[model samples]
Target: MDQTDREILGYSRYVVLAAAFSAMFIISPFEYAWSSMSGHIGAIYGWSPEQVALMFTTFIIFQSVGMLPGGMLRDKYGPRWTTAIAGLFSGVGILSIALGPSYPLVLVLWSVGSFFTGFIYNNAVTTGNKWFADKRGVMTGLIAGAFSWGSLPFIFPIRAIPASAPPETFFTVVYIMAAIIGGVSIVAALLMKDPPSGWKPTGWVPKTKAIARPSEHNYTVSEALKTGQMWVLIVSFVLVSSAGLAGMSNMVAYSNSFHFTATAATAAAGGIALANGFGKLTLGTLSQRLGVENTMILSYIVSGLFLFLTIYAGMNRSEWLFVCAAILAIFFWASLFSLFPIAIGHYFGEAAAGGNYGVLYAIAKGSGGLYGGILSTMLITQHGFPFAITIAGVMAIVAGLILIPLKYSPPIWKDEEAAAQLNARAAVGRR
Candidate 1:
C-alpha cells in the first residue's frame, strides 16, 4: 500500500499549496498592476512614455530570464532559502522606485527585483508539479491564477491616484506595498518543500480518462532539448506570450489612445486582471478533460479572434465593447501559463520539471517581452494601435495552428528499458 501524505509529511499537501499560492499573490503587482501605476510613476519621475515603457520591458526581460537559474537552484537546494531571499530583494526593488533614484539606477533596482520575481514564480507554480501529480491541472491553475488576480487590490487604488497627486502621497503607498510583499513572501517561504522523488498520493492510480498521462521515463534537460516537440513548444509559447504581454503592458495606453474616459479605461484594466486570473483556473481544469494540446489550440485561436474584436471596438470608440473584448482576449491568453507548465511536466517528466520548463519559459517569454515591449511599441508609433494589435492577434492564431501536429512520443530511455526487459523475460521463460 502507498503511504498517505500524513504518514510521509505529517500534514496535508494543502499546506504547501497555500504557501505557494500566497507567495505568488504577493508578487503580482510587479507585473499586472504596472500599467495602472506607470502613468503616475512617469509623471513623478519626469520621464517620457518611452522611458517608462522601456522600464517595463526591462522588468519582463529579467523576470523571464531569471527563471532558469532559479529553477535549477530550487531543484537542487530546495525552495526555502531561495524564496526568502527573493522576497527580500523583490520588496526592496519596488520600494527603491519611490525614492526618486536616477533613471539608470531605478532600472538596475527594478531589474534585480524582477529577477527574483522569477524565482518566486518558479517556486510557487512548480509546487503543484512536485506535490500534486494527480491534481496537477487544478493545483497549478490556482497558483498561476493568483499571479494575475492578486493585483486586484492594488490596481484600482493605483489607478485612483490622481495624475496631480503629490510625490509624498505616491511614496506612502509604495512603502506600504513594499512591506506587504516582503512580509507575506517570508512567511510563505517557510512552508514550502518538495515531495520525495516519485511521490504520489496514497492509493492513487494514474487515470486514463485524463488526456495526458504521466511519462514513464524522466528526461534530463539536455535530452529534452534534442526533441522536435520541445522546439515546437518554444515557438508556440513565444507567439501567444507575445500577444498576452503586449495586451497586459499596453492596455491602459491603448485605451487612452482611443479617447476612452478614465473610468472606462480603469474598468478595462481591472477586467483584464480578473479575466486573466479566472481564465487560467477555468481553462486549466478543462485541459484535463479536453487534453492540453487540444485546449491550447482552441484557446489560442479564440484569444486571437478577441484581440481583433478588441481593436474594432476601440476604433469605433465603443467603450464597453472594447473592455469586454479585451477581457475575453486575456481570459484565453493567460491560460498559457497554467497549460504550458503542465504540458512540460507531462512531456519531460516531473523530475526536472522546474529546470526544463524554466529553460522553455525563459527563452519564449524573453523574446515575447522584447516583441511586446520594444517591437510592438515601435509599430504602434509608426502604424498605430490597429496595425500592431492586428499583428499580435494573427501571431496568436498561427500559434494555435502550429500545435495541430504535436503528439506524444516516449523518451529514449523508455524504449531501451522496454527492449532490455523483454529480452530478459524471454530468456527466463525459455529456461
Candidate 2:
C-alpha cells in the first residue's frame, strides 16, 4: 500500500481505482455502442449512412482534441471539478439527443458531449498512471478495459431495439443512458484524486533491470515532443488506432454486408465488446512480464492477421468464423489503450503523464478518427468493405513493424552541463 496515499486520503488507492473504473465505464457506450444505436438514429432521422458516419467522426474529433486541455487542467488543478463539470455536460448532451432534434442539432449535442467524455477519459486513465506506478500495467489496464466492456450492458440493450422501433423507444434508452453517465460521473469525481507528487507504494523498490522501467529523467510535454521516439509512437498509434476504431465503428455493418442474420451480427458485436475489454486486461498484465514493446509488436501484428482472416471469413459467408475472427482482431487491437499509456509513463516519466500522453492521443487518435470514419466510409462506398478492411489490416501490421527498431535509452543531452541540469530536474520531481 502507499502509506502517503493512505495518510492523505484515509483509504486504499484501490478506492481511487474504483472511481476511475466507474468513470471510464460510463463513457463506454458513447463509442462502443454507437454502431448498435447508429442505425436506429439514422432510421429515425432519415439520414444517410455517410451522414451518420460523420457524426461519429465529429465525436472523435472533439473527444481526442479535448483531451489536451483536459489533461493540462487536471495536471495543474486535480480532477474533481473538471470531471464533475464534464460529466454534467456529457449527461445533458445525451438527454438532449433523446429529444429528437434535427440532424445538425444532434451533431452539435453529440460533439459537445464527446468533448466532455474526453475530459473524463483523460482524468480516469491518468489517475492510474499517476497513482499506481508500481503496478501500472495491471492497474491501468483494468481501468482502460472498463471503457471497452462497460458498453456491454448498453450494447445488448441497444441491439435489442428493433429496426421498426419508434423514436420513443430510442428516447427511453438514451434517457436511461444519460442518467447513468451523468450520475456516476459525479460520484466518481468526488472520489477521484491524485497521489502526493512523489508517492509510491511502501517497501516496494523500482527494479532498475525491469524491461519497461521508468526513465531516469522526467520530460515535459515539449521535451517529449522533441524526441524521435515520441514521433514514432505517434505514427504507430495512428495506424493501430485507425484500424481499431474502424473495426469498432463498422463491426455490425461489416457483419451485415455479407448478409449474415441479425442474431449473428449482434453476437459479433457483443463478442468484440467482450474480447476487446478482456484482451486489454490480459495483454496489459502480460506486458508487465513480457515488456511493453514486445507485447505491442506481437499484439499489433496478430491483430492485423486476424483482421485479414475476418475479411476472408466474411467473404466466404461463414458466420461463426466471421464472429471469431472479428473477436480476435479487436482482442489484440484493444491493448493499444493500455500499452501506450504505460509506454508514455515509462518513456517520458509520470510527472507530466497527462499532458504528454494527451498530445500523443490528440494527434494520433484525432487523425485515426478521420481515417476510420470519414475516409473508411468513402472507401467502403466506392471500393467496398473488403478494400477498406484490407487497408486497415495492412496498416496495423505496419504499425507493429515500426516499433521493432525502437529501443529505450536515455535522451542525448547536448553537453554534460545540460545532462546535469536535466537530472537535477528529474531528482526534484522524485522528491
Model 1, 1-431: lDDT tens digits are 56777766678889989999999998888889988888888888889878888888888889898888888899888888889899999998788778674988888898899999899999999887888888888899999999998899989888887767788887887888799889998999888888777788877776654544534677778888888888888999999999888877889999999999988889989999999889998998888888888888899999999999988998898999999999999999999999999888877877788888889889998889987887788888889989999989998999899988874443345586688799999999999
What does the lDDT read for residue 259 in candidate 1?
95
What's model 1's TM-score? Answer: 0.95
Itemize residue pairs with steric clashes in candidate 2. Answer: none
Candidate 1 Cα errors over 4 Å, as ranges: 209-214, 408-431
Computed on alpha carbons, the lDDT of every model, listed in order, comes to 0.86, 0.86
Look at candidate 2 and tell me the lDDT of residue 116: 87
List model 2 lDDT by residue over 1-431, tens digit each.
45677787888789999998999999888888888988887788788999889988887889999888888888889889989999988887677666555777778888899888889988998877798888888988898899898789888888888777778988888899899998999999999888766667777676634433534566789999998889999999999999988888998999999999999899988998899888888998888888788899999999999999989998898999999999999999999999998888877777888898889989999999998998898999899999999999999999999998775443443454487798999999999
Cα error of candidate 1 at position 410, Å: 7.1
Which candidate achieves the best TM-score against the true structure? 1
Model 2 residue 82 distance off true place after TM-score fit, in angstroms: 1.1
- What TM-score number comes out for model 2? 0.94
